[model samples]
Target: MDPYGDTLFNEQAAQVACQEIAALTLRCADDQRKAALLDLAELLEACETTPGSDVLLMGD
Candidate 1:
């Protein structure tokens, strides 16, 4: 089995995305600053847990 071929593997990709958003938030202009900050906060909240398939695997 090749783990590198797995589409479900994230390797903390979401965390990386959040970090990029944070950098943008710091540099966002005044007009769009509030929205950018809100976006960063929302992404942070959504990343608190890993999402799983509704159907259980054979082990479950």
Candidate 2:
């Protein structure tokens, strides 16, 4: 599949992903994973660079 396909890349999807991440982080009781995830989040925030779209995905 073409990752840059129009239907797959949208602001709404990104907002949902961010919301899901916040929800999952709140529900998570695992300290290590939470820390890691938050750390990554912070690192991303600090970096001036960001991928154009769909840089990562959360999953099983």
Best by lDDT: 2
lDDT string, candidate 2, 1-60, tens digits: 545543332344555555666777898899999997776555444332345544343332
* Candidate 1 C-alpha lDDT tens digits along 14-54: 55656777777778778577696766556554653456312
Q: What lDDT score goes with residue 46 in model 2? A: 34
Q: When superposed on Cα atoms, how far off is each prediction in RMSD?
A: 9.7, 6.1
For candidate 1, the clash count comes to 0
- Residue 16 displacement in candidate 2 (angstroms): 0.9
Stretches of candidate 1 off by over 4 Å are 1-11, 33-37, 51-60
Candidate 2 regions off by >4 Å? 1-10, 39-52, 56-60
Model 1 Cα RMSD, 1 decimal: 9.7
- Per-candidate TM-score against the hidden true structure: 0.45, 0.45
lDDT of 1: 0.53
lDDT of each: 0.53, 0.56
